[model samples]
Target: MKESDPNKKEPIGKLISYIHRTQLKRMSRSLGEYGIGGGGQYSFLKAILMSPGTTQDQLTVGLKFDKATTARSVKQLEAAGYIERRADPEDRRSHQLYPTHKAIEFQPVLQTLLDESNAKLTRDLTDEEEDQLIALLQKLNLED
Candidate 1:
């Protein structure tokens, strides 16, 4: 078998996966002190904070996570004192999620951490390049 060319461009999926893993490591380290679990947990918390009273189903769909992942993240966030679930009057089987006072107080810090992480991720790129990269990534259909 012939060896592949080292100069060949990597596949987009591989590149995206690598970038995702790197981002997750950075986020996990940054959020460890605040009791937020790594990966999608902080994303779930942010969504709940931004839109209180959202349901788990909504989060699952909006965040593109499976139902079980959404449920698990919510549970972890609740146990960490960042969020609470209240009974939904409209649906007895479902609960609405809300950020607790702890989460509210930490919201600004959360935003700052996220901003710093993003800035680090794009530090090598010019502002225009960053904007173009964002636009190009957004053009992909990453649903499910």
Candidate 2:
């Protein structure tokens, strides 16, 4: 066991870490049930949909993924016909990401999965508690 340092600790780490781990597992299972397998693909899909021509590098940096993994995952999605890489009118060297019709077809399914996940997570919490939890997560993000 590692020695404990009395001076060191985040007051909220235990609850925060539990929430994070549980969220990831639930997200994975939700995506798995939807045939998306939850991964960088989910991030990529969301990023591209929000800013329809985002570059691979933008995804790598924005999503905090390694460049190679981002590239490979994009390639996989491309092969699966979920997304397309188009020449960026702004930059000849970088291609932009766009969702294909195939991906759009899956949007409703994905949304249902998200709705279920959200309902499960909030089933026992009041509206105020949900808001407080979100505020706490937002505070944590500001720390980063």
Candidate 3:
């Protein structure tokens, strides 16, 4: 196969991957002041905060993460005092994840950072383009 030309159109999947990596790196740096080591745990914390009493198994399936990754994030957040794990009433084998006061307090700041990143990413796109992009992304996401 011929080498791809940089000046030519790039694959959307590759572009999205680059964006994901860069965004994660930037988030990790920005969140350091708040004691959030990396941005990986942010989503888990947000999910738990949004749905209190969600179990680790639920998080694993809901977020499409492996069980080990989910468990590690839960453990880290719990150690940071950002979340608490309690025995599930229905299933003693599983534990429910819940956000602590610290996690709740950090949400607004996290949201602002996310909003800013979104605005920056879409700054070049028109309103219609932004809507189209979101629709396309949703369609792609649903394919999985």
Top-lDDT structure, candidate number: 1
List candidate 2 segments past 4 Å from native: 1-18, 33-35, 141-144
lDDT (Cα, tens digit) per residue for candidate 3, span 61-120: 998888998888888889889899889998898888888999899899988887887787
Each candidate: RMSD to true structure? 3.1, 4.7, 3.1
lDDT of each: 0.91, 0.77, 0.84
TM-score of each: 0.93, 0.75, 0.88
Clashes of 3: 0
> By descending lDDT, how would the candidates be arranged?
1, 3, 2
Compute the lDDT for candidate 1: 0.91
Model 1 residue-pair collision total: 0
Q: Which stretches of candidate 1 lie over 4 Å from their true place?
A: 1-6
Error of 3 at 104 (Å): 1.2
Superposition TM-score, candidate 1 onto the true structure: 0.93
User: Candidate 2: lDDT over CA atoms?
Assistant: 0.77
Locate the minimum summed-lDDT window of 10 residues in model 1: 1-10
For 14-87, candidate 1 gives per-residue lDDT tens digits of 87987888888988899999998876688999999999999999999888988989988999999999999999
In angstroms, give how far residue 15 of model 2 lies from its true place. 4.4
Clash pairs detected, candidate 2: none
